[model samples]
Structures are given as C-alpha cells and as structure tokens.
Target chain A: MRTALCSLLDIEHPIVGFTPSEHVAAAISRAGGLGVLGCVRFNDPAELDEALTWLDGNTDGRPYGVDVVMPTRVPTEGTAADLDKLIPAGHRDFVESTLTKLGVPPLPDDDSPARDGVLGWLHSVARSHVEVALAHRPRLIANALGPPPPDVIEQAHAHGLVVAALAGRAAHARAQVASGVDLVVAQGYEAGGHTGEIASMVLVPEVVDEVGGSVPVLAAGGIGCGRQIAAALALGAAGVWMGSCWLTTEEYVIGTAMPALREALLAAGSSDTVRSRIYSGKPARLLRNRWTGAWEESGAPAPLPMPLQNLLVSEAHRRLMESGDPSVVPMPVGQIVGRMNDVRPVADVMATLVAEAGETLKRLGELHP
Target chain B: MRTALCSLLDIEHPIVGFTPSEHVAAAISRAGGLGVLGCVRFNDPAELDEALTWLDGNTDGRPYGVDVVMPTRVPTEGTAADLDKLIPAGHRDFVESTLTKLGVPPLPDDDSPARDGVLGWLHSVARSHVEVALAHRPRLIANALGPPPPDVIEQAHAHGLVVAALAGRAAHARAQVASGVDLVVAQGYEAGGHTGEIASMVLVPEVVDEVGGSVPVLAAGGIGCGRQIAAALALGAAGVWMGSCWLTTEEYVIGTAMPALREALLAAGSSDTVRSRIYSGKPARLLRNRWTGAWEESGAPAPLPMPLQNLLVSEAHRRLMESGDPSVVPMPVGQIVGRMNDVRPVADVMATLVAEAGETLKRLGELHP
Candidate 1:
C-alpha cells in the first residue's frame, strides 16, 4: 500500500502515467498515481493551459505532471528572433513533399497550427511552454529529451514543483541528477517515445547506482503491471512511469483505430515496433507499419531535422486519423503491449497492478528461507 | 573463388563458416556471405546435422557450416539409458545449492590457464559432437561453447579448412575464436550475439562492420552492407547469411529466440538485449534482462529441459554444450546491428549478391522492376 514512490509524489502509488491526452491524464491522476502530459505536441501555452484547466476539474486536486523534451542542443531555438531562419530550403522542401505524399492537407490559414512551434524537437519553444506551465499548480515537470535546462529546474524549484527528466540509459540519469532535477525516469526502449538502449531491469539498477539516491528514480518503459511496478521499486525505482498502458483505457479519446492497432500488436504478444524519426524527428518507438515502411525503403530521403519532420507529418497525422487506415499508420506504444492483454478501465487496471504487485512481493518475501 | 556454399553445394558462396560465435559466423559469412552456422542457442533443432551436413564441403569444398545447440528434446541423445532415471546426484546437489543461493562462481575457469576440458555448458561433449559435425564436410564448423566439437566440420570435409566462432561483447579478438578457428574474431553487443543486441557500427561493421566493409557481411550485426558493406563488403562478407539479418535474413532460424527474446521484444533494435536464460534455460535475450532476472531470482527450481526452458533460462541443458552456468544463456546472434543499419545483406553485402541473385531467375525477381 505504501511505497517510496508514493512518498515522493505524495500519492498512493508510484505509477506515473505519461500521455498526451488530457482525459487519460486526469483519469490516471484521479485513480492514484500522477499523470504527466507529454508536452511535445502542444504548440501554444494557451492550449496547455486549457488542458491543465480540464485536468484540474478531473483530478479534483490529485497530483499530476507535465513532460517536455529539452534536448541537449536544438537548432530551432537558436536566437530570440531568428528561430525560423535556420531551417534550410531543401529541408523545408522535403517536408512539403513528404506531407503531400502522406495525404495530410496543408495547414489551414488562420486556423492552422502555429508556425513557430518546436514540433516536439525540444526547441526554445518547449522552454517557453515550461515557463508558462510552471505557473500552474501541477505537482511535477519532466524533461522528456535531455535534462531540463538549469534555468527551468531552478525556476521549478523556485516554484515548488518537483522536476524530473526521462533517461533511456543510466548515464543520462546521472546527468539528470547532476543537473539538479528532483527525479530521474529510467525510460527503457520498451517505452513509447524516445528511449535509450538499456532495458528496465538493467537500466533501473544502473541508474540507481549512478544517481546514488540523490534523486528518486522512476522506472519507465514496460512498467504496466502491479508486479512490474513492484519490480521497479524492487530495482530501486521510486516510481514506474507508464505510457501505452493508459492509451487503451476507457477515458482515452483516441479512435479505436490506434487501439485496434495496439490490440493486433498485443495479440502477437510483441510488436514489429521500430524506433524511427519518420514521425517525430527524434527516434521514437512506433509500430512498424507503412509510414515507417515507406521511410525504410531504399533511396528515400533521410528524415530531416526535428520540427521539420514533425511539420511534414503533422498534416498526415490529421489525415490518417480521418482516414482510419492502419496500413499506413503507426500506433506509438511501448514493448509492454505484449503483456498488456485485454482492455481494462484505468481504475481496474491500476487496482489490479497494485494488488498483483502486493501478492508478488509477498511471494517474493516467502522465497527467503 | 570456389566455395563449398556455391558451385558445389546449393548456396551462392564458397565461404561456409557456421558458428555459435556471433562474430565468426557473422564475420566470415558476411565477408563472403557464405556463413551458415548453428541456431541451437537461439532455439531447439530437429536434427540439424542432415541439413548442416548437406551444406558441408558442397562448394567443391570452399568451406561452410557450423553446428550448435543448447541441447535436445524427446530423450536427450546422451546421459542415462532411461530419461527420468538419470538425475546425476552430485549435479543435482550442486544445482540445488546454486539455485538456492542464486550464486555462480566468478569466471574462474576463464581465468585459469589450464581451464582445458572443463567443458562449458554442453558443446564440450564428444558423442554429440561427432553426431553432427561428421555428417557435414563443412568448410568450417564453429563451436561457440568450448574446445571446437571433436573432429569439427573442417576435418570431415578433409582439411584445408576454415573453422571459426566468436568471443566477447567485452574484450577484442583474443586467442579466442581463432584458436579453434582459422579466423580470429570478436563481436560486441552491436552484433546480434547469442540474442545479440549489441551495436554493429560500434561492433562491426567496427571490426569489419567496424574498420572495413573492405573487411567483410562477413560483416556482423548491422551488416549486409553495400554502401555500408560496400563500406563492409569493401570492408568484407565475401558472402553473408547473417542469421538475425536472416531471421529477417532471407532464411529461417525461426522460432528460436522468437518466443523468448525477439518475439517478446517491444522494440527491435540491437539495443534491446536481455541476456536471460528464460529461453533454452540460458540467459539469452528475452526482452530486457530484468524480465528474466525476476524468474531467476524467484524460488523456482533452477530451470530444466533443453530447448524447452532453453527458452526461459529457468534451467540448464545437461547434455548440450549450450547449457549451464546458473542456466543456459540465450543463443542469439546480433542483427547487422546498427550497422545492420540497413537490411539488404543478401543483395547489398556483396556486388555479387545482386548480380548473382539477379542471374538466378527465382521466378520472384522477374516481378521486381
């Protein structure tokens, strides 16, 4: 019932669910663990504010977090005024051409998505959002890319918000700790988006070793069960960060197409998931399907820089959602899909995971002579 | 120019170097694309000797084939007359102690200068050795377990042979794969080693995929290079049949590490290495190492059944060279690794791959534009 993770977040469970949907985020937070919304896709601070406002009503004061990717070095964030100047003609041309091929119509005029947004590449734009987001009463702020900039962490600390950064490898966790983030998430390759080489098992303990308890470590990637959550704690992770598991839940507003794709993947007990920059510019785990397949074919232009690629895919993402064709689509999830059997409600899933983990721990205790 | 794999046998190259050694099987064959070895470590087999031997000395004796295994099914070909009647008491006692303690002696046998005949796992046995190797006049028979199987494939095919296997994700080429083999080798995780999830760019396509395609798909993990192999074929793979590249490789080593590691894997990168024995009773790749570590640390009986638990790492294969040491390790090879960067080894690893393949008229090529 009690865990160090819960103590860190002041919640009942160490399960921190990462998602882009406000509905799912609120449900997870209300269920128990904090729900951190992925901020890579949000372009405007107002939009994030709206989502947070909705989350506020849904969570009823439960703790939640915001995840932003603050990459090591971003080109788009070059200067105060010349942010868009750095993108080259060829890259821009490639983006335009890619969108045409994917069938996503061009961005609408005044109704179009913002032109200056970072497109999930961890640009200066993401940092701006972080500043605006910290003003809210959210419990945590996580950097999904590299460590949060010193200013962001300092400001967050100043604002009384716990800071976290996602690490795919152990060294990254150490980097997060040294950078002064309050927590480090050991995100495994099984995770939905950007991740490092190490698995949760190897990665968690390694991160634990590297951080040496200076910061609480949350095990991300394939943590979808009570036993898995318990395992994260057992391996020294203060919390378990889950993403895909929540996407299939009842509250998720995403179409059945994506979940159906995930279900097909679940049946195979694994996925043909490969990390490609075809969707978002950075390497993110996605089901291996036609879009990625197209990128993989010979003579294809190598994916361009972050925001550019995101720019290219954004229209297509909308079109595909409208079309509901999975052959040309990818449902981004973690390797945990294999273990994520049937669909379950967020509350039931959380309860099952916790109860099963308790039993596993008890069984584990019984193992001792 | 002649090869046991090509003009003689039915394959396309004269280079036949079969190995459990990730580096050798990958290196030599990738070098010439004539590599064909054992898949036992990856999964169980149905008397591979016939197929292996059929491949032997075929390239008018250019060289070919490696025979391997974790062990067997039905009554194991070795041990007591009756199956269940045979649990060696001392062995059982040792296993019980080891399992209960969750302990394994450090690589003492490895450090020992006279570690001879200690026989790791099972490949050390003579009865099983001749059973397979003698059947094939392999250009080479790579035995990854230990002291190359007695009378190795080269000897049966009448010498002037090339025998090799791999060693280490750790140290570089040593008195290792070369001592028993004609070629000296080393495969980092970049290689698809025993579930090989190492890096080839770092490993190879470093060693060969590493320093020179001029070296050889004889290139490992991330190989089948044209530009890369053109970089590795230029570096090396006179011929290559890289297993994982072949699992996706134009061949079949299917159902081996599938259910255990690759099948359960969320993302398919050389980075997802979970060397656990939940498969083949050895610690192979079954997702992240953490998954297996749980079953391992559980108070279960130290795994049993060859290819059976060989898939789980829960037990050790008794009569097989691939088992033992706290449990059989997963027998997987790396894909060209990242250097596998591309997936066209069958065609790209060699200039010959395309031209020769083009000439074959397999009824399928006519369809390609």
Candidate 2:
C-alpha cells in the first residue's frame, strides 16, 4: 500500500473512499486512507459549510477531500426555473404515470421547498459547493464530470489543494491533464453515477499510458477489495478510488431514509445493475429495478437531457426513498455491489483490503519462482 | 513471464496469438508463443485439414492450437440454406440498399459457389472445424462462444489436448471450469469479435477470483503490448491471449483481399470501434464503418439474430473485400487497434512484447522502494 500515492496524499494506504456521509469520511481518514466527501447532495452552501466544519473538527486533523459534479456539457442555461420549462410535458407525464402505475407513494407534506435550486448538475450550484468546500482546510477537490474549468483548477491550486478530475476515457484523461489537473481518476463503465462506455481494465491502463507520466491516476469502478487494489497498481494506477463499497459500511448505515440500501446491494449481482440516464440525465450505473426497466422498455420515452431529466425524476426518487421500498430506491452503485455482502465498519474494510492486497502481492512475487 | 502457464502449455512465453492465417499461427509458434488458428473461416473440413497440414510442416514441431466458434445459444437451427430463409426480407433490402448507396462494387467473378454453406455461428459447421482440428497434433482446442459441448471437451482431453473456452462473465468462467475446461480466456468488452459488456480490467480480476483456483485464466481483450501483458498478470491472469494485434502483422497484410486492413487498423484509435450485433447477431466489437453506421442510424432495421444477421451481411462483406474498399470491410478488431501502429513480422512483435513486459515488471518492482 506504500506507493507514490501514499506520499502524495500523505495517507498510510493508497486507498481513497468516496461517500456522502461525514462520519464515513471521517472514519476512513482516521483509518489511514483519504476520505472524500461527495458534496453534490449538499445543495445549500451552509449545509456543505456545516459538513466541512464538522469534518475539520473531526479526523484528528487528518486531511479529507470534496467531490463536486461539474459536467462539461451543460444541457441547459439559466436558472433552475428556466430549465424546468425546457423539460417536455410528455416526459413529465411518463415519469408521473410510471411512478403512479408502480404504486409509489408521495413524500409526507413537509414545508421544505422541494430542493428547487440545488440540482448539482447546474454549474452555478456546483460552483457554490466549491466555495463552501474551500472555506475548510481540505487537501483535495475532485470534479465528478470531465475536467474542471481552468479557473477552478487554478483556484484550488492557489488554495494549496490538489485538483483531481474523473475521466471515463483516455482522451478525457489527457484533456484533464492538459488543463493542469494534479490527478486524474480514471473511472470505468462498471462504476456508479456517471460513466462512459469503456471499462476500467482497458481505461485504467490506457489513461495511465496517456497521462500517468504527468499526473497520478486513481483506478475506479468495481473496486471493492484488496486484490483489485493490487490489480490497479499493476495497471499503473497510483491508487484505487472506491465509492460503492463504502455505501454498505456501518457508518453509512447509521442515517438515511432507506436502511435497505445495504441490503439491496448485498442481494444484487454484477449483472443486476443497468447503466441508464434516468438517475441524473447521464448514463449512470444503478440497481436494476422498475425505474430503470420502465425507462428502457418498449414505448418508454427517451429520457430528457441533463438537468431536465434530473428534475423530472428527483421528486419521484424522493417519494420512493420515503416509501422505503428497496426495489424502487434511487441507489447509485457500481458492479462491485456484487462483492459487498457484509455490513462492516470502515476500519475493518480498510484493514481487510490492505491485508488481502499485501497477501496478493506476495503471491504475485512468487509467480516467477 | 515465467508463470505456471509457460510450463503447463510447454511454451517459452506465456503469450498466445489468435489469427485466421496459417502463416501467422506457424510464425507465432516458431517465435516461442502458442498460436491458435481461428478455424471459423474454414467452412470445409478439407480446407481446415489443408491448413493444419501446412502448419504441421512449418512450425518446427512447436505446439499450436485451434479455435472454433460454438455458441451456447443458437439463434436458429437448420442448415445454412434453411437458416437463410429465416432472414427477413427487410434486412436483406437494407443491406443491399445500404451497400449500393455506399457505391460498393460487386465481387470479381470466381467459380466458387458464393460460400453459401459455411456460416460460422452454426454449430454443425463449427463441429466440422473441431473434427478437422482433432485430426492434427495440436496442443490446445478452444471454443470461442461458450463452454464447449461435453463430448467436445471429453474428446479433446482424451487426445491429450488442452481444452480451453472464452468467458466474458465470472459466471461463464465458472461454468467453463465446471465443464472441465483446462483454461478460461476472460475476454473483455474491448476484445475483437464477440465480447460481453464487462471491461477486461474488472472482468479479468472477477473471473480470476472466481475460477483461477480451479483452472488457469488467460486475460484477453485490448492486450496488444507488453505493458498490457504485465497488467494482465498483475490482475492474476495466467497468460495473455491476443487477437486483434496480429491482424496488422506482415503475414496478415499479405494474401488478404483487402490490402488496406493494416492501414485501417493503423489509422484507428481506441474509440474508433463499436460493439454491434450487425456482424454476427451477437454484440461483437468491430471497427466502426459505413456498414455499422448504416445499421445504427435512424430508420435502420434492427439486426436479426445470429445466423440470420450473419447471412444478411455476408455477401455485402464479400463484395466490399473483393472491391478493395476499406469503408465497408468487415474487420473484427479490439480497442487495442490504436496501439497496433506498425507492419512487423510475427517474431519481432513477440520479441518486443517479451522485452517490454520485462521492462514493465522491473519498473513495477521499483514502485515499492
């Protein structure tokens, strides 16, 4: 685990965990790996500020990172209200009809204004996230989609923070490196959230060969255990960036509307997930259920692009989550869900990964003999 | 490079080349790596026998192998003529109209019966390939589509020949191992010909973890260079099985109707190919061309199942090759085509792979220190 990445990030192990929970991130940082908090869910800057403030006080002064979803292609321009008008009536009808037909109930009548302006795919919304994250003493900031803007990278560097960008293609990795990103997270198709068509095995080595000389690459997608970490290093990746595996961690299990998220993942197999655009208007891998199937089956309308699609399904997702139906929950997960069969603590997961990878390396060392 | 595969296969290098040419296979075997001849092209048993006889005389007693496509799911049963009738008239019209619109000329008149009986996907045709290959003193016999039939595996083993099968999924690998396969080639999505959606990076380790203890696993798909071979080994592959890289060799460059195959491959990048069922009714990766575009564009008819789809486009491919048009040539290649940029001999390619892999291993060895 003591590779260049260990020294670069000043972490004991070359493993980076991505999660939305502050507790999981703190636990991972305390366990000697970099814990990156996914800040897209924090629509309000104050919420992100409070989360970062908590992270700053915790983790025994260890460094953590923040991930923002800043897609290169903004399908629509203007405010969220203006974007809402662009979503077609037919698409809205289909989403509502499908959810209603599936018997999904609506959320309880609470006075929260439906999370209107905080859609993370909006550049303006994500920019606020960067602002909130920089207010804290985090060491790294990663853009979830494509290369971050040149100014964003410069701003992060000016603040003494490393700027990392996720690339699903070798060309994207090269573009990110050219834009002065300090690190490239080469994500594969098997990964959750947004992804390209290329798989991790081919994408990692291709990106490593393309831009690895200039910037370190973190192998992502379907990375759950220690042997995969070893494999990533063999592919010339500096480390492994894992997100889906942490979703089932005990820290993540503590909060959230759906306690069945971990149970759904445990029950799923590698082929049980589908890459569909219904989640966020991008081809993201998610658990195959009525939602994904309805969007793909015959007579289903083509999903609206970007922010429009995300808006159409956001309320439905809220309802499904509140309903607590594991089958309909909007869980973004990777194919690695097939391997995450247990509910363990972050420390136990990290220890097992490190030990298994150490043993795998020792076994590989004996291959020649 | 000195893994158990070398001793098990009695080869100096744990690299295997898959090619349709007898010359390339013999050249590869003589260069210290096993060369598996793809027998799907030989519709007649006599043609395969003739090819094997030539290999026997040329290889200096080195071990070689044969590969036949025996798909688990047969789209339609019956003879080629019987299956030819099953192809819809609309698909035939589309193929003819698309090719004519592209201005592809007809094949030069030769006295052969237009190759009507030898559809590769048909099990009856593939079984003849097996019968012909068994008559030769080959070291291994591999089934391309799925696990070989029980009788096929039993027969191959009884002759002291190693039985191998390709798998794109972990479950497929496990099934192949359970069916008594001596080796499982984990072909990823980036591979040429037929492939699954799982990328080699994630798929290799998954398949390796699933079946490596039961039998050896060979990593295939996007493996064109030595560094890739090193990565494959790092992913726990016993050896590397490559197909697309050999398509650009000098031997392949000669005696092929389309002299531009190598040029096309050299001009291609990793993203230049697509996985479409237009070629074989199964989602096989191919260099994107006018043919692939015509089938996928708006108003295009959905491609029929296996033999029917293969039948729909066979004549058009023949005419394209005979006309020497690169745009319509049916070249099944992997994403590694981007890395294959030269016209070298089989021996030089093998030597460079061995040397490059050695250097990569040494470089990785320094990563810890």
Candidate 3:
C-alpha cells in the first residue's frame, strides 16, 4: 500500500496536486496527498497571509505546499551595470511599438496597481510572497521557474521546509540539484502555466538519469491517471505533480470562459494549444485565440520583459475575465487541458488517479518479471 | 537559389513535404496543394512500385510525391518472413520476463544484400537505384533518414518530378527544410513514426510564415492542426492534410493495439509517449514499455511483420525478423516526440509568422481587399 513517493513525502500517496486556489490545495492534503497552492498571482504580502490563514482553518491539520514564480532571470536582479546598461532604448522602444500595434491600450485611469517597473515588481512580490509563505509552516515551497533564491532556500531549510524547483530540461535539473533543492520537477509542456519543449515520456527519464537520484524527481506536466502515475514511478520519479487536472475540479475556481474553452479543448489534438508570451511576458501554453492573434500579428513588437509585458496584457486579461469572452482573452493553461474533461471533487480526482495507478502497477507486476 | 520543390513542382515555393508513401491516390489528387511523405515502414508490391510510379510519373509531373522509411524501419523489408517466423520459442522470452531482466543481444550477422527493410541497403546501392530513378519521372525527391527512397521523386519528375518527405523537427528551418524541398516541414507529436512533441512552435507559421513564399502547408500529424492552420493560412498555408495527425492518416492503416491503448491514449496527456508498441505489436509510442521489454529480452520469442520484426521479440513480432539480435536494430522516425519542452511551434516559433505571411502574398501580388 505504500509508494516510494508517499514514503519520500511522508504522505499516503506520492501525488502532489498543483492548483492556484488554496481550497484545492487544502482539500488534496486532507485527502492524504500533498496540495501545492500556486502563488504566481499573489502580488501582495497581505494576500499570502490571508490564503495561508484560510488553508490552515480548512485543512484541519493536513499537509500542503505553496508555489511561486521565481523565474530564471529577474529584470531587476541585474546590478545597474549588468543588464540595465547593456540593453538599449531601441530594444525597449521596439517592444513598446510592438505592444502598441497589438492594441495594448495605455494603462487605464482607474488603476494604479504595481506602478513598479518589471524588475521592481518581480523583486518585490517574489521577496514578500516567499517571506509570507514561510510565516506559515508549509511542508514545501516550489519555485515555478528556477530554484528558490538562495536567501529563500536558506530560510526554508532553517524552518524545516523542503525546497523544490521546476526544470524544463536535463540541464536545468542539474542546476536545480546543484542549488541543493529538495526535489527537482522535470515539467513537460503538457503542464499548465509555464513549461518547456520536451515530452514527459522522454524528459522524466532523462532527468532521472541526469539527476541520478541525488534529488528525488517528481514528474510534472501531463500526469492525470493511474497508469501515468505508475509509469512515472517506473521511470524513476518519486512522485507525480499535476496542475491542469485540478482546473475543472469542483474545488477549482476557473470561470465560465476558461471552463468553456477547456471543454472545447477536449476535442482538440494535443498539438492544438500554443505557448506564447502573449499571456505573460514569458511563454506559457494556452488555447489559441484572437487576442493572441492581434499581439502575434506578423511584425508586432516584441513583448517587454516579464512583469512589464505581463502588466500590459493584464488589462486585456482583466477585460476578458470581466467579459467572459473567449475570442480576445488569454486563458492560462497547458497542453494537459485536453485531459481535464470533467468536473470532480479534488478528493475524488486524487483517489481515482492513485487507485488507477495502483491497479496499473499490479497488472504490470502480474506480467513477466 | 531555387529548390526542386519550387522549380520542379511548379509550386510558389519549394516547401513540399510529409505525404504518405502510398501509391498515390486521394479522394483524388491535386487538392490544389500537395502532401509529401513521413515515416512509412510497410510496402506491398502495389504500394512501393505503384505509389512511386504514379506520384512521380503521373500528375503531368505536376508536383506530387512519395516517402519511404529511412534506412531504419524494417532495415531490409526484403527479409524472409516465413523462415524468420520459425525461430525457437525461447527467443521470445521477454513476454515471460520483466524488462529489467531482458538480455538484449548484440547486432546480428547482417550480411544480406537486400535493398529494403531497416538499414536501407537498397538506398546504399546506386545502380539498381539509378535504373529505378530513370523508371519514374518526378520533379524533386530528397534523401534523409538516410537518403529518400531510391529513384527518389525528383529522378522521375525530371521526366518531370516534385518530391519531398518528412525530416527532424530541429531541422525545422536550418536543416530539415533549409536544404530544399520545394517545400519545408514542421511536424509535432500528434504524428506517428518516431516523433518529438514540441507544439509546432507556431512552427507551421514560423516555417510557413518565416519561409514565406518559399513553401506552403503540408502540415503533418496533428494537422488536425485545423482552425490553427486556418491561422496558419492566416499565417499563410497553401493547403492542409495530415497523417497520424489523423488516425486514419487516410485510413488505409489501422491495427490491433486498438481500444485499450487508444482509449488509454485518449485519456492521456500530450506529455505521454509510449515507446512501447501497444501497436507495432512491439512497443512504440505505445501505452507502456512492459510489453516492449518483454520482447527485447535475450531468450524471448521472435518478432514478425515487416522485415520480420527485425528480430525475435514476441510470438507475434518475434517470429518475423529475428536474425539474432534486434536490440541492435534501428528505430522508427516520426517528427512528433512528446512535449519535453513547450515550444508550441504552432503559432509562436517566430515573430514574422503572420506579418510575413502577409508580406509573402504581397510580394507575390496576390493580395485582396
């Protein structure tokens, strides 16, 4: 009844459910697996505190983790002499003109959020969010892009929390382990949010071989079933970390537009979705749409760096969120959307995946050994 | 500066590629555009000889094509299926043993003078090939995956010919498409054969839009690349037809690995890659490898099928091609691998994807209000 992964994380199953909502995270934990709350959008310190408080009250003492976006490169992390001096105005203008052509209207008069530039916003939110998450005793903290910043990692270990980071390739996995991360997640493109080019089938094994078990690799991206969960362990993964499968669950708060788009995705071939910075300045896969079309218009300007470009598109996203229009909105999702076909409770979803994987393993075990 | 793809086929550009290597038939032909070749390992007399002769020799040498398996697949489709199928049962052991325990042997004594199946000995010979080339008159035939099937499409089209087939995705522009095809290529996972899954990177347009006026659509597996290709044409595509991109890649080929594997696959994510052949009966991008490893074991049964499974792997496949060792055999080649990284070549490979699409038509003086 025990899985190597469950043993690794001291849980009933090695499943780590990834969701942007605190409710789903707590529910998964209560269901006897780890719940990872996505914190990429938690731009304020107070919000992190509130989410943790909510999770604490709801989980009834179950374990959970938190995820944050600590990208490979922070625009502001470069010393004044590093990038600020090297990148020129022409590049910046080229970016401006590009967004302008894409119908990126000027910042509206009613909003005054994050006046901070790209570098400033990244630094501020990343720092405050990590600090806030640490305040609560989350079992793990995963950095969506890279290993947690050194300071963050130092603080987490000091508090007995394990640190994990997402890696899109073999090289990235090596870097993550060298940074002393507790786990390395080799995320396949099928994952929601941001991911890389390799498939889970190939990437996971390559990473396991590369990391050589120095760190446990929890496979991420498109892992939604028992068979896949079994395969990950067969491929040497200690656990399976998922995101999209949770999107349509009852505990997920995805709105009408997203749910509708997600439904349409069920009929699509896996290749139908695309990864474009049009959603965030960095590439993240989502359903293709007209808003992406306009921004991607042939010679459209380059998207500005992370937070700035994200800031510009945030308005379009807000409008779409408000209007529920599929035509001009950026739906943050992954190739795994094709698999999130039904609405189930987070607990049911977890149980089904684990149960299925166990059956698959048993069947495999029945085979010639 | 012109490619045989353009000059020979008389298409706007030389980007012709990814056609099934059948004897050339459609609901009929010239859908106004053309489809080339990908990874096809099987060949009956009617198909190999007839398909090539017709695609290249007929069409007024207009610009149609044929593709053969690279020197890999059956290495020598000429292997004796009858005798090979008679191998002892012990050789088919993997079916009775665990994969980790299978003892894959070294390469066999490959002294045969056959031209087809696997290593493509037929292609390595130039005389029988030159005569074959002269037999057909096609425009442009290419050689990759170890030189296109001999007599290639170009040799015939010269009597008038326009031929092209699939290539590796990394070669999307620089290598695969750059050298020349009258057309270019950018295939994604939804494809068959051995493939890598990196969502077309908006690759269709990157290649289509980037290679502007150079080639047209021939989109591959996932050509069910659909409204997306509508976007492709918006990005610019002459036409679109797909292969595994369609299970019935024209419907002629469908096999047993059906139902369970297929259903399992439907429930699978883009992250899935079954190097096991729930299909090839061997283990290909199948549901799992347990079945495949069962065959690769040292004392397992022999493999059957094209070129005789190339070795003794299973009762079904094992009886077909066991010369001694298939572990030393060549693997299949299809452009779609699973998504190890999220490049989404679909709409986002390059910035010029759409604009240049406009520019391409503009330069061609084909614009409309």
**Which is the leading candidate under TM-score?**
2
Interface RMSD score of each model? 23.4, 2.7, 22.9
Candidate 2, RMSD to the unseen true structure: 2.0
List, residue by residue over B1-369, the lDDT tens digit for candidate 1.
232224433454433334443333444444554555664442223345544544443333444555443221222433222332444454345444644454433333443221121122344343354455555555444444333543554463364445454543312333333334444233333344343333322233224322222212243433332222221222123333344444333233332333233233323443544554444443344333333454555463555544333222223222111223213233344423222233333334445444433232221122112
List residue ranges in candidate 2 displaced over 4 A: A115-118, B115-118
The sequence of per-residue lDDT tens digits that candidate 2 reaches over residues A223-320 is 88777887788778999999999988888853356475666777887777888988877789988877788888888988778877777777787776
Give the TM-score of chain A in candidate 1: 0.87
- lDDT of all predictions, in order shown? 0.53, 0.84, 0.53
TM per prediction: 0.53, 0.96, 0.52
DockQ of each: 0.03, 0.45, 0.02
Clash counts per candidate, in order, are 127, 1, 127
lDDT of 2 at A33: 96
Residue B280 deviation, candidate 3, in Å? Answer: 25
Q: In candidate 3, what are the lDDT values of residues A333-364, reduced to their tens digit?
A: 66655456678898898889867766555543
Candidate 2 or 3, higher lDDT? 2
What's candidate 3's DockQ score?
Answer: 0.02
lDDT of 3 by residue, B230-257 (tens): 2223223443334432222232233333
